[model samples]
Target: DTAALMKTPLKKGDTWYLVDSRWFKQWKKYVGFDSWDKYQMGDQNVYPGPVDNSGLLKGGDSQSLKEHLIDELDYILVPTEGWNKLVSWYGLLENQEPIARKVPNAIEKEMRKLFSIPDEKEIRLWNKYMSNTFEPLNKPDSTIQDAGLYQGQVLVIEQKNEDGTWPRGPSTNKLTLTLQ
Candidate 1:
């Protein structure tokens, strides 16, 4: 009977009384039904059943009952922060495993295509930008001296930030840059 009831197709607006024994007890306690007979009589005042759309569950018609059931199930009502944390935590764990183990080579190939590295010109431009923006905090053996020209566009390197990770003392003499 319970399985048949679950299989029953519920329309947009259909009134349903609490007949399930488990739900009946909960409903009786929730509404404070004094007598079991009164609760079973399908009384409107004590146990109202109205075909309404305002409070229906995802697949049922009755907001209050649906909410009660969801609460009873200890369902996790996820907020934006919870969802973000879940995604971030999953990402951290997922990165620990190699992709080749989880997906087929076809998927790996597609991912490789999607994240293909840029050409030499793009790298030069990026290097130039890095040099101009960051002031070298320390002197370095090597400097971004020049960016070659490509497609008639000249690439110029500029001083950016001093490499903070330099092994020696704070030289405040090195320059970093990138070309466009």
Candidate 2:
């Protein structure tokens, strides 16, 4: 009869517990979660990659018009150092002849619309997925489609590295872009 007197009524999804000083830490466990500010700190890269129409993948706050150009133009040639590696690594390798095959030079208008090439620097695109080999569409009459580039593929813009060396090799760039 004494034991029955101590029994308490319970409800569904409710727990009955006898907590003490030791339970203080246990109670805090329920609140263990990340806030938006904490989640905001994420990996950032030096260069940008190809972006979607809205530029969500590139991070809306940091999305650059250069990145959007790749998505906008019909056939814009990108330089090796121009595109973001962390962004467009996988898309380029999915198609055959992933190499900068031979897009026609007529895309010059579109390419020019993207950016003006300096006398020293030529607009180029590369596959940094596993390699740093950059191919330049020197001829404006050429289209990158001939360079084995398909829709949604990415090519890095070729440029001088900090050390004044061209990005190269699987060691430096990471993988060889073997074209079929």
Candidate 3:
């Protein structure tokens, strides 16, 4: 249904569309759950691996256009430096920001149209789920693999330390994506 829906362009100003967020399941449990046993189911917290958007296993193949666009629009790509540029364009970057990430205004407009959020006050979305600090969503604290994001999901920036490096945590190099 998602693939069929995304195949065409949406022209209406504010229409709701399906967004994949199976990737953030563990992160949700990590931040929201009171105990490990509550969210754990076998190796559920562990990163199993990446799969195609249709829930099919895709050995070593690259992400399809649908998957890429879904990730790009959902802010699931936040861990990469590319995400910084998108965030900057969203005008969320603060003064003295470390990175200079920007894209052309025309492209930004088009992107907003495609991934239009239902709520302009997107900060509420993040606060509703996790604390203001990115510490709970930190790679070290969560340890889950990167995954697809749900609709209306806002990207949370992991604050860098005073030493000009990211906070100390286990390096989560795993990549796992799921869509539901």
C-alpha RMSD by candidate, in order: 22.6, 25.3, 22.1
> Whole-model Cα lDDT per candidate?
0.29, 0.34, 0.31
lDDT of 2 at 14: 33
What is the C-alpha lDDT profile of model 2 across 42-72, one tens digit per residue?
3232112223223212344332222322322
Instruction: Please tell me which predicted candidate would have the highest TM-score against the true structure.
Output: 2
lDDT of 1: 0.29
In angstroms, give how far residue 105 of model 3 lies from its true place: 3.7
Name the regions of candidate 1 deviating beyond 4 angstroms. Answer: 1-3, 7-38, 56-180
lDDT of model 1 at position 110: 27
Model 1 per-residue lDDT tens digits across residues 49-168:
221222223343332333333221323222233323333533312112211111112222223344563222111112222335433312121221111112222232222234533332
TM-scores for all candidates: the values are 0.15, 0.25, 0.21
Which candidate do you rate higher for TM-score, 1 or 3? 3
User: What's the CA error at residue 70 for candidate 1, in Å?
Assistant: 4.3
Clashes of 1: 24
Off by over 4 Å in 3: 1-20, 30-63, 67-75, 79-104, 108-180
Candidate 2, residue 161: Cα displacement in angstroms equals: 4.1
